[model samples]
Target: MATDKIKLEEIILKAASVGPYGVTDEEIRNSLPENVAPNDRLELYNSLLQRGRLQLKKLHGKLFYQTVEEQIANKLQALTAEERLVYSQIEGAGNKGIWTRDLRNICRLQQTQLTKVLKNLELKKLVKPFKSVKLKNKKLYMLYDLEPSVDVTGGPWYYNQEFDAEFFDILYQQTLRFIRGSSSAVTVEQVASYITSLGISKEKLEHGDFESLLQTMIYDGVVEKLYQRSNNGSSVAVYRSCRHFSPFATLGDVPCGICPVYKSCSIHGVISPSNCVYLQRWEQSLDF
Candidate 1:
């Protein structure tokens, strides 16, 4: 009888070993030999757990069993049918992640159903949701253990889904400091050179990278963009720091500056700035 029990337990472990998510109690029952009592199966589960030959994990209040080596695999067995399908697509997506709409298209699930499955996956800690930096309106889903690609996370321009205005502000100050000490207007290339010289960027700065920052400074009314005549009769664009520029200049604090949903804020959407209470409060704070 003991030998027969060992054989049955081997069959259970074998079934669990095939999938990364291991096997659930129902799976074990289906694989068991005929005439095996439910009590005997439960006893075998307990025996395997006690002897450290198998591990048990509870996800969504259901038990799954697998070997210690396949622990991550066992996590998949915990998902509902829809959740498993969604998770597989996400896992196959690797770091780049799949978009919400794309997920629905691929899975052929309705919007409402997909939303529920995503929420459940999030609750189970199986996946994470991130807003794409380049496509601010797009939400991407990836495995919880994975780090999103720079494009999805907004590269270095953002910090944890929020724009890193402070970082650019520091860069702005640095640019001004470099210009104030110089006698002539600085070309964009020169500015890029100065930024590169500071050893601040993990990767080397390219001319294109500084263009965005330089354009931003011009828009902020702190730096002037000009054209310098070249010896070849062509023109070279240059930047001159505003002589009376105020380092502490700002238009004023708006609610979006401190709002947590600022990352997803849009003019027309579920999380639009027009519908924000914080923005309303800012308007109300001023006396008419």
Candidate 2:
């Protein structure tokens, strides 16, 4: 019997192999074992997106995707560094984020050493884990632990909002959509209002708290800063695809050949899998 990963890879390759395109949820469902639930496959689909193997989008309230390769190369080609700076300080500079274990695992540390950096980070509001649920049984850190670049909510910036992960997810997505439509570079204030217009309640993102997703996006190399004139002057940033900048991935470089998308991609064109049975189909497709 074929493994679930193999089956999903087949589905993704088929969908991505074509162009001017879309692949329906049903088409996705058809590729999986019939006994599996629809939502189960949807979960699988989402995993692929998070792994950078797929690019998920909502159109007229319907979700669809193409390969991350095509999406980065096409939909995000016009993205500029100036626009990327729009959300630079949502968590701002000088702040850091790392997994709980990795923090504990950094070299030159005692094996049993423990500190309340997480707690201190929380108290100063310089960092936060962002989500309510624990992923990998660890807090997913964010930029809220850092000082805010401006009063995100005092007036025009809007900061009195509550926390809702989905809303900020859309805010980050709004930055992406804004980049897609921007004929020229704009400010973070412009990006903020554009995000608010997406029907995400402004009350949830008034403060710098919810902008963590955008921070992670920048750290991940999906977006990059163009420039900064003064500490807070018209600091323009341009956004571009990380593929050209870092196909090897930036933030999530857990070493070895264990990446979720390794079976289907090279992230960078450097070292890769070949003559290995695990990638026979993908290799065949690449004519390797």
Candidate 3:
């Protein structure tokens, strides 16, 4: 009986190790040893649940069995009803985070009351607030332990809720240098690997970030992307420094090229190019 119990525990642990999303009942059942009786397995499963070793979480309308740490469970249990409600909503938002106004509406709590609850959660180190890069003035709340999504934090291109143009320039220059220094065309993976090895960023950067940088370079006419057939006849994209790149401004070199509000700029409107501060600044910076 003791041996059977140990086997059941091992199987349960194995099934729960898949990921944070947890495993389904069907998965758990398939993992159980054939010799273990259905009633015996049920007893062990119930025993774990009663002891708070496993938590049943409903995600996307389906129930999953997730293993929760005892300390975390204890912390959650200690939360007041309101705090739990707020926390659950923030957790549902995931890494993207929930805005304070949105949270208020969703929780149906008054502004003053929501403020107090958020402060309490902050004090308890259960949740935190951060400014989103897209909306610098607005703050978003998320679970304390989660890293904000790239969409919220604007990846590594931003710092302190502001775009770090200097950092971006450094990456741009370094990427160009790598491409120019290489004898042959380089793949995005090769360029990303090279940039990562340089340890230029304090925050983690994804491969897509470097790929975007390369794309920008391509747009600037400084680098060109070429496709080459691989050993298995798959086309592989590779980048090389342009041999006869034009010195004239490419689309991205102009102020309007990368402006977020370019669509709103009209010939004789409030946001026309004549009154554009960005274009004015670019003009002033030009020596000629």
State the lDDT of candidate 1 residue by residue for 235-267, as single tens digits. 999888787765434444665666777788888
Q: In candidate 1, what residue range of length 10 has the lowest lDDT sum?
A: 246-255
**Each candidate: what lDDT?**
0.79, 0.50, 0.85
Ranking by TM-score: 3, 1, 2
Q: State how far residue 130 of model 2 sits from its true place (Å).
A: 16
C-alpha RMSD by candidate, in order: 16.3, 30.0, 4.9
**Under the 3 Å rule for N, CA and C atoms, how many clashes does model 1 have?**
3
Q: What would the per-residue lDDT of candidate 2 be over residues 1-288, giving only the tens digit for each residue?
A: 358666766676576545534566766666556787767676777666655566654557776666655443342333343222221222222233344455445422333432344454445444555322223345435455243223221322232333355654666676776755777554555666766677666354553433444556678667654555756776565443343545534533433345565656554545465434455553354421
Candidate whose TM-score is highest: 3
lDDT of 3: 0.85
* Candidate scoring better on lDDT of 1 and 2: 1
Query: Which 10 consecutive residues of model 3 have the lowest summed lDDT?
Result: 245-254
C-alpha lDDT of candidate 2 relative to the true structure: 0.50
